[model samples]
Target: MSAVVRGLVARGAGQELTVEDVRLPRPDAGEVRVRIRAAGVCHSDLSMVNGTLAPPFPLVLGHEAAGVVVEVGDGVERVRVEDHVVLNWAPACRQCWFCRHDEPWLCASSGTPAVARGATADGAQLHVTLGLGALAQEVVVPQHAVIAVPPALPWAEAALLGCAVLTGVGAVNNTAAVKAGDSVAVIGLGGVGLAALTAARAAGAGPVIAVDVSPAKRELALAAGATDYLVSDDRLAKTIRELTEGRGVDHAFECVGRSATIRTAWRSARRGGQVIVVGMGAKDDEVGLSALDIFHSARTLRSSVYGSSDPDREVPELARAVLDGSLSLAPLITDRIPLDAAPAAFERMARGEGARSVVLFDE
Candidate 1:
């Protein structure tokens, strides 16, 4: 049987989202139905609305989310009904080539069910973004698409573990593996960059520098453990070098996902340092680097997809950090609105208003 639910749906490319009636079906084999409690409004969601991503039309756009399992389908044993879970947009298929090589984060089959599952009141099929359309009040996803989280974790905070926290902290801990005393610089102080800042501080990295174009985010960055802050400008690389005593940071993270910021991250790292790209840029956008520049600079440029994380393992560790007070998820949430206000939340994100704007379904 299918149930009628209200959800935000994009009718066409570059169209505003409308809350409409959606028909959700019961979970099938190896799937589970989740009652979404909180969903983070991300830049990626905004990109989808503006056609930065070529997702099918009439799509439900959301990925960073947390919820409770209401029911499970046949063969679903990893999670039971009433279990709290964080939705994983990139669920690894263990049989994939990358999974076989122990790189499940790069799983070739991460994006599955390319077709949408639900339909509108008028009977038009609706595509669920990232195979886990969580913007709806409830969602049906594969068992592997949801990871059990600590019961004590708040839904608003737990929601971030799905995307921002996973990517940001994972970049520092798993992707770059920043060692103690290593100098780090993060470009673009959004939710992801701030998470990187917090993780660097927790890892005992020294002289953590934060770069951003917005002056409003400086205070938040500092509070999140940034040792130094700089406004994004032509002198960003030079400023970072000066802060690290003229050698540039040992590791530089680009979270802005733009060609210019990526170049900045490259220039902000030490000659032989690591430049980790954590942002998801558009396919048409390209970054150019001279042959000599690439050869002369002995730095390693790597892309950190989902923070090179295995959700089952890392989400629990991150939840523990929140419980122990070593990691602060509270400061990362700047705005909390109801589900109806989600479109406005995206507007705030476009204007660089805050770190994260989470839609509270419990409100």
Candidate 2:
């Protein structure tokens, strides 16, 4: 059995995304079909069209989403119909060496830019981003790709847990291991960066500094619990140091994913501080560091892939936090739009106009 649904499709790089009829096949064994409730318009989704990531053409372009399982294939016992779930882009294969070593985020079987799935209305073969193209009315994905969450979780905020919240919060708690009173600087004020700022405040970090190129983000930064907001400029590192009592912050997070911003993050940290790279960038773009600086600074530089998180274990915990009112997602969502308005949301994202523009599907 199969169904035709409206989905956002990108024909190629530098082209506008279009809403078109997509033919979706029924779930195979160990798979489930979800009725997408809300999907976040993420930077990584923009990467698919901006040439930062070279995915195949005629692709569906979303991975950060939440929905209700409406159909389950044979052998799919992890989730059932009517269960609310968050999508996991990088589902770990537990048998991999990295998974056995307690690093499922580094699971060997993940990381494909796109996977061949259903087709367009005209019968042309189509591909879905990260193996779960979710910016659509519905999606059929492997059962492992969906983690069941509380039914009461709001759809818009639940969508963020799959990407922005998970990646941003995980980078702070797991990758950087930020403790209370640890001074922190987060460079970039996008959804992930803002999430990092919120997580820092929740962890009891002091003087959480939020840096971005846009002066318009100051209010958003403050609301996200940033004690200070600085517009990125040539003297950004020096300005950050001045605010941190001339020693820089204990942790510097680079969420912009460019080499230039990575360098700024490195310079914004104290000599022995940790620098966590949370952004996904092109493979060709390289960061250059002097051998002398490396030896003298004694800093630890690492990349936090998918926030170094295990979604299966963490998404439910995050849901509990939301239910208990300990964590608030209100600051992260700037706009709630219908699916047809997704292209405009992408334009706003490119212009650095908002934090997150979520596409809401009708119930």
Candidate 3:
């Protein structure tokens, strides 16, 4: 009831990810096995490999993925075998405090993953990332972590829906709630930042401004619905204000996850506007809050995780958006490399050289 699959495992900090033959675990009680089709190369996965988010070594390092259900364990009813699903890292324990409070994405019992080794292989235990290390050809995830979607949905696009798209679009639609005709600014033109741009446009945000250092990515930002693109420069805020009739954008999204970019997000928004932080930076890194700015600027700053979305509800909805052409995922998929090219793909992401390079396993 298992398969020997190729997976990327990073043994320790500053170590390269090794492609190893690993054992896939069988579904435990209330769990399901997924035949992974596509896995997006997220920045978090890069962070793990580069020692940004320090976790235990010798661990599998992927979470954003979409696959088909291959089998179901006893007492599992979330989805039937053969259904397509997107892997959800924030698996909600419905009875938990955050889940009970209508915030399933922040489910109190949802963060960590338990290594489920049906039988030991190489005398080492197998651990899943966020309960769904889906980088390999197959993955075993808890029933709650798989949100069933239409089989008609392509795996590559659905894979991104698992994280980046959800986080970006959800930030605008759910967290900041940018209204129609509202001017918005997005700091950082990575996957999530571009996603935020298009999502704001879909919601009727006027004059969506995208900021990034890479001119290449700035062009990509325009294609993804950014009305204006700004390269790194002085008077960035002044330029944004000039575009918005001397008042800054109503909402600003910080997708770079840096203290400096966060400050940009705060300053980019107009007085009484909102700033939503969507980046996942170092936990110890702090964003300075000035006493005068808070009182005089009339601005609101907030951090949003996973776009504040209900996975079960929003995953399928976002997929539908892609299916119906409301959400454009084609441009985001800038590169597709086979499983063997994963290392280089990671390198490309580390350098911020590509939009998205998904590892296609289906072949």
Candidate 4:
């Protein structure tokens, strides 16, 4: 038997999303059914529609989400019915070479942009974002797609832990290996960027500068523990260098997934510093770099996929921090909205108007 639930669906690229009935199949062996409680509107979700990514039509949109396991398959053991969990969009295949080598984030079998599953109300085949169309009220995913978290964790905050918190913090701790007193500049003040700021501050990084195209993000940047905020402009690199006393920052994080922003991040770092690309960009959107500049700067450029994090080991630890109040996700969530408001949330994200607009579901 299948379960019917409401989900946000986009029939084609650039089309307005519609709330429609989605019929989900029952969890088979090694699978589980999750009732989504909260889902964060992430930029990656926006990419699915804004031409940055090309996913199948009639796609269910969402990935950053938290929910409860309401049904478990015969072989399920990691979670039980009613267990709170965070959706792991990039679930690792433990037997893959990456997983065997401790690089599960680069799991060979995961991270598909869209997976064919379920059906629309009219019985047309459906595709889901990142294999977990969490914008829906319920989803049937492989057991590995859900990570158990503290039950006491709020649904909204927990949803963010799946993507924003994990990616941002993981980029800092795991990918960049940022140490105390390291000067940092983060470009883009979206949910992930702000989360990066919070993690940087927690790691004792100083002069943590936040940059974004929107001037309105100043307040958000400061609240997220940034020592300074700058509106992204032609002078961004020079300004960052000035703030760093002509040395530029030790690390520059490009949270906006654009070639121009990537170059800006590259320029915002000091010679021999690291420029970490935290945002996902379109493949054709190439960043032009001069060979002479690369040699002269001697800076390293790398991209952090899923924060280069293994969600299974990190989500539980992050949940504990949220439970103990050692890690605060308050700044990450700018609004708590109902599911119906999800389309508007995407608009806000497109405009770079807020940090994160979390869609909350009623229990």
Candidate 5:
């Protein structure tokens, strides 16, 4: 049996999120009901509040969550009852061209068939944030969106691998694939930026420069593996070149979603280097780059969605890294609040004052 639990929901723009009791129905075929243990409060939630990620009304606003599987619907063999798991927002359908071609992250972009999963408590059907909305105490998601984890990994630490960690680390390791001894510059020291720093360090990158406006975040970046830190400003481009002996770093990752930061990430890369745009800036915003630069610089820029990840393969490996102390996730948490405090937590994120606030639930 599953219990109705509290969760944060954005009714609309400029409106306070109301904490409500929502029900979780029994899992249908190819579905599982998860009892969410920890949900990360991400900036995307603030975007939803301010009408940035405008999808639907009264949306459950979080994508980074991990929990336990208490019940599995029919034909669910990958996970069993009581199995610990990480909820992935992007699930790939095996038959899709992207999935069959070794790029599951680009899975056809179709809606999950609702016949496989039951409706919400209020009988008002809703779409999951990227497909797995794990913010609630219970989530009825397709089996493909769930990644089972080792019991030793705490739910809170594992939650981030679902999105933030994957986007950050995967941007460097998978998308950029920066080589050992390469120089890196990462703009925006949020959760993903910090993860990028750690991944860059692990990849043997030298002089990994971290750029951000927040000094607290600069400190966080240093702890995560940044060799140097800088404040974001009009001189950011010039400073990045100055740091890399007037050549700039080999790779630059923009994890913060903004046009200016996006351009900064581009300029931070050395000529012929790679610039990976991991940030999700406004669709309307455009960057002004001299057409000659494309030919003159020979740099490569690519969009990183879900960190180009295959969750079934990446989540468990990340969890193992966490267990070995090579991946420091437990310390990244700045606030741990109950499900009721989600609104306040998101507000804190909007103010750029929190590291990673997680919403916990009694399981």
Candidate 6:
């Protein structure tokens, strides 16, 4: 048995996505077939399309999604049919070197072809993005890739938990270990930036500053609990320092995934402060710093992959925060459209139009 479903497929680098009929096979052993209810359009997906992060072509390009498990293959014990789950793109293999060493987010086998199991209508093997493609109405992923969430959780908001929320909040809570009264600045006001803002506020960080080039995102940032907002410009670092009493923020987050924004994040941090890189940038893009400056800065630079999250443990906690009103997933979702409208959504994202645009599927 097979399912023919419409999905956004990227046929080649720098090409626009085409909605095509994808033929998905039934769940193989250790796999689960999910009926995607909602999927978030992320910059990472755009990177795959634009050739920044090269995945195999003819790929289904989406990873942030939530859905219901409609069927499970033999030996699947993590979840049962009808279980609501947040699709985790990086499903760690516990026996892998990274996982055994407590760095499961960097699991060696998470996003390889060895884990993908699907095909296209023409019988060509389909390469799923991050090994958990959610652009389609249905997906068959490894059992570990689906983390069960409460059924009461709304599919649209829960969809973001897999990517933006985990990366944003996890960066603060797990990676940076932000403490109360620490000054924080987030350079970018997208879903990930807002999630950082919300987590910073929850952590009692002082003067959580949000920076972005777009003036329209000020309100969204403020509503997400940023104490201050600044537009990205030549004097951004000076303005941030002035706001922090001639000292830059204690912690700065780079969420835009560009060399320029990354420089801004590094320059906006106080001496000895931590600059956390949360965005996924192009492999070729590089940020240059003088040797003397690096020596004198006395700052720590680190990258936060998937928010340094262990999905099995963090996704549920994040969901609980949303359920308890401690976290605001509502502000992050700026637009909701059907799957066919994903191209327009991508255009909006490219224009920095809104925070997140989710593709909703019929119940």
Candidate 1 whole-model C-alpha lDDT, 0 to 1: 0.88
Which lDDT value does model 2 have at 162?
Answer: 96
Task: Give the per-residue lDDT digits (tens) of candidate 6, residues 1-363.
Answer: 988888988788878788899888888999899999999999888888776776786899899999999999999999999999999989898998999999999999875632345677788788788887798899998899999999889998899999999999999998999999999999988889999999999999999999998999999999988999899999999999999998899999999898988888889999899999999899889998778878999989899999999999999998888888778788899999998899889888888889999999997
Model 4: weakest 10-residue lDDT segment is 346-355
Superior by lDDT: candidate 3 or candidate 4:
4
lDDT of 5 by residue, 1-363 (tens): 545666566667779877766555678899888888998987766766685656665566677899899888999988999999998777788798888899988889633312222234576654445555567778888788789999999878989888788888899999999889899999877778878898999899988999888777767878889899898889998998998899988998988888788778888889998988887776677788889988999999888887888888999999999999888874367888998888888777777774789888886
Candidate 6 Cα outliers beyond 4 Å, as residue runs? 113-116
TM-score of each: 0.97, 0.99, 0.95, 0.99, 0.94, 0.97
Overall local distance difference test of candidate 2: 0.94
Those runs of model 1 whose alpha carbons end farther than 4 Å from true positions after fitting are: 112-115
**Predicted candidate 1 versus true structure: per-residue lDDT over 119-235, tens digit per residue:** 989999878888887888999999999999989998988999999999999999999999899999998877888899999998999999988889888899999899988888888
- Model 3 lDDT tens row, 1-363: 577877777667788777777887677899888888999888877776665577765677689999989889999988998898999988778898888899987888776733544322464776656667777788877788899999889988999998989999999999999889999999887778878888999999999998887888866887899888998687888889999999899999998888888887788889999999998888778889799989999999888889999988999999898899888886687888788788888888778786778888963
After the best TM-score superposition of candidate 5, give how far the Cα of residue 6 lies from its true spot, in angstroms: 1.5
CA shift of 79, model 4, Å: 0.9
Candidate 4: tens digits of C-alpha lDDT, residues 1-363: 999999999999899988999898999998999999999999999999999999998999999999999999999998999999999999998998899999999999999999999999998999999999999899999999999988899999899999999999999999999999999999998999999999999999998999988888899899899999999889999999999999999999999999999999999999999999999999899999999999999999999999999899999999999999889999888999988999999988888798899988988
> Residue-pair clashes per candidate, as listed?
0, 0, 0, 0, 0, 0
Q: Which ten residues in a row have the lowest lDDT in candidate 2?
A: 323-332
Error of 4 at 136 (Å): 1.0
